[model samples]
Target: METITTFGPLTPAAEIAAAFPSSVQGKNIIVTGVSPNSLGLATADAFACQSPANLIVTGRSYDKVEASITSLRSKYPNIQYHALIMDLASQSSVRDAAAKINQDDKIPTIDILVNNAGVMAIPALTLSEDGIETTFATNHLGHFLFTNLILPKIIKAAQRSSTPTRIINVTSFGHQFSPVRFSDINFSKRAADLPTAERPDLEKTEFFTGSSHAEDTYYGFFSYAQSKTANILFSVALNQRLWAQYGIASFAVHPGAVGTNINRHATPSEIEQALKRAAELGFDAASKTPEQGANSSVLAAVDPGLSLVDVAADEVTGVYIADCRVDDANVARFATNGHLAEKLWSLSEGLVQQKFE
Candidate 1:
């Protein structure tokens, strides 16, 4: 297999797609959060450039999804495009969307599943309809359930294809902001109130934990970070459970900072604060275009070079990818913890009220 040794942060998605045409051509691909000018649409466009048999793009709004599909149709007239309305914050919507995809004759299997839709830095301590923290619910739980519900399709695809079926969870380097608050995931308890041993180190600092009061302790960016951490842990657990038995490989990707609406919920000061912290950690803190952000995901989705590695021996399952290659230095230790991964899997199963082996 040829290696993508030269791929980097600035590499275009089309160039990466061109490297492994066989991995994407004639395959079924699905990307979430595909509104205009978003990373999801960019990823879909990348796959379309490779002649995928069916490209499914999903979003919370019908009109937006249709608009995305229309855009793809205009740009890639020969590729078949489908639209799905999936509000990841709602489990019912996710289930409905999954059923529709499963029953659709056109989408026999899902070759690549990109859990790309996410909300960042929600200004308030809002809860989803399911009563879970809004960011956690939408970013992690929703994709957790949706992916499991569609696993059969992915498994079927794995069985038919020689290469491993891929699941790319779009996480952010902001995962460095915090780990999963297992004891107080809803932010109902302040750091000071928690048992000294159980309190997270970051929460001890006001910079990470915004408010001193339990009721007002919800910092939007920290909550978003927790959910992003869950995305990586979920990928770990999914790969650990399915790789040996099903040939399904999962990856967590940090799609470099891109100027997109995912930041709409944050105030200018909040954005500045986040970037300041990122720079303090020695991160580049530089922004990329939507197409550049999509490159990491595109590589994780179809890069044949990844398939040649020994997942178990190399501990490749749930490996984090950045700038189109495996890069774990930026990931928090907790995000890659196997025990936390399993614990998260159980918690997710209980939350969704569905169990998967």
Candidate 2:
């Protein structure tokens, strides 16, 4: 398929900012995870300049949400701003937030939704209140619900006004590890039997001690990889559903490693230092500033030429993108093994059947 050679890794956000069409002048856009202190804030800032009809920013914490809104308002005094508190780990919160956004009086339609929030490697396994794994809960399931909930409003608005609605799932390249384990998602039974650190002395040591699952056996990196891969698979599946019917195109993006605070989930210092060293060497594992990381997400959300892709297309959808461009290798793998993607989608759906169905 034909591709844009201009899009490249380490592509500056300013380049993306330059590509945004002037047509978004009065459009309604909602960006999740845009707390004042996060990379989402940079994304909101970039989009804020385009003067959308309404800009709604969200975060898991109320304080961060308010702070982000306050900062944006001061920076862009004339731009429309709205802020909401949401924790993606909780299904009820996702449902409530979507409902509230759909019902807002000023916002007659929803144009673009960006799912940019994510968590990294957590040493210990934990579950959300809804009883799903924390990593899977926050990274994939929450955004899935948010998109579906607001889809109708977005589609209706798009239909009435001829405005295209876009859903961008922010993903990562680290999703190359173990595919989804459909059988055991929550690790409920496993978590229950695991010995806590408080138990100092170990009497019978036939296997792993602190964590029931050995680090080598069930690497934290593998769990993270599974979640990120789910993000991509969800986007591909979602794109097929929405693009054919509603003309609402969905895309997944792996914002090349950026030096951000997405690593707040009990990651080891050794891993942290490794990331730092890799960043210095200009590897795919590196992190850019918050602004740089937010660029691709904004592009996927607002760029008008998204739906145009061919099978031979380089850097295309239903594939993984890194450094602001698509990876050819991932595309080929996905095209061949669609079952993996299908299985992940089904497994995720099963886990959250209560909230979504």
Instruction: List where candidate 2 sits over 4 angstroms from the true fold.
Output: 1-8, 161-163, 188-218, 266-269, 272-286, 307-318, 330-337, 354-357
Which residue segments of model 1 deviate by more than 4 Å?
1-3, 195-216, 307-318
- Candidate number achieving the greatest lDDT relative to the actual structure: 1
lDDT of 2 at 27: 81
TM-score for all predictions? 0.92, 0.82
Error of 1 at 114 (Å): 0.5
lDDT of 2 at 36: 58
Task: List lDDT for all candidates, in order.
Answer: 0.83, 0.67
lDDT of 1 by residue, 1-357 (tens): 234556988888878888889889999999999998899988888989889999999999899889988888888899988888999999999999999998998899999999999999888889999889999999999999999998999999999998548999999887876778887878887656666533444642345334323334777777888899999988888878888888888889999889899989888776676566667868767888899999989888887667432335323333788887777666777788788888889989999999897
